[model samples]
Target: DAAYLQQQLQITLEEETGIQSTQGEFKFMVAADAYEETERVKVNYTSEDTLQQASTSGTQSDNAPVYDSDGSTKVV
Candidate 1:
C-alpha cells in the first residue's frame, strides 16, 4: 500500500511540477496512522523563487508500432 501510495504521489508531483514552474522541490511526509473512511496524506513543497523557470521540457514521446504495406511493424 505504501508503494502504491508513493507511486501516486510521484505522479501527482510530476503533474504539479509540469503545470507550474515555481514548484522547485517537493517533500512528502506520510503519517503512520490509517483512517476508516478516508486517508489523508500531507505534502510539502518548497521553492526558492516565487516564479522560477521551467526545470524540464514538457514533451512526451511513445514507442508505438507502425504497420507497413507488407505487414511489417516498425517502432516510432
Candidate 2:
C-alpha cells in the first residue's frame, strides 16, 4: 500500500479540483514529499521472546551498543 499511496500522491493536484469535488470545499492534504520528510514513530521494544527481547540490564561499558550515523545498531 505504501507504493500505491506514493504513486497516487505523485500526480499534481493543483488543477485537479474535480478529483476532490464530492469530498468538500475546505478539505486539504499534505504534499507527498512533506509526508516523506516527517518522522512516523520511534518505539523501544521489550519482550521475553528470543528474537524480540531487549537488554533489560541496560548499557554497560564493555557491552554497550553502537549506533551508526545511518540508524543501524550493533553490539560492541
Candidate 3:
C-alpha cells in the first residue's frame, strides 16, 4: 500500500513540475533523494480500560480522554 501511495505521489509531483515549467517557475521540481520514507504500523489501544481503571476516585488529573470513531477512548 505504501508503494502504491508513493507511486501516485510521484505522478502528481511530476505533473506539478511540468505545470510549473510552463508558468516560468522552476520551484516545483520533486527530489526523491531529499525525502526520507518510513513505514508506519497501526497500534490498537484503549485508554479507559488501561488508564481510567488504574486511577482512583478524586485523584484523577485534568487530562481528558480522546475517542476514536468507534467510541473507544485513548489517553493523549
User: Best candidate per lDDT, number?
Assistant: 3
Structural similarity to truth (TM-score) of each candidate: 0.27, 0.20, 0.31
For candidate 2, report its TM-score. Answer: 0.20
Clashing pairs in 3: none
lDDT of 1 by residue, 1-76 (tens): 9999999999999988786654332211122233311333221122423223233221222444578989998766
Expressed as tens digits, the lDDT of each residue in 1-76 for candidate 3 is 9999999999999999998786664332333323322111111235455565677542555465678999999876
| lDDT of each candidate versus the true structure | 0.51, 0.52, 0.62
Candidates sorted on lDDT, descending: 3, 2, 1
Q: Is candidate 1 or 3 superior in TM-score?
A: 3
Can you list the residue pairs that collide in candidate 1?
Answer: none
The total number of steric clashes, by the backbone 3 Å criterion, in model 3 comes to 0
Worst 10 residues of 2 by lDDT: 39-48
RMSD of each: 27.3, 20.9, 21.7
lDDT of 3 at 37: 24
Over 1-76, each residue of candidate 2 has an lDDT whose tens digit, in order, gives 9988777776556336656763454343445445544533212222234333334344345477689998799756
Q: Flag the better candidate by lDDT, 2 or 3.
A: 3
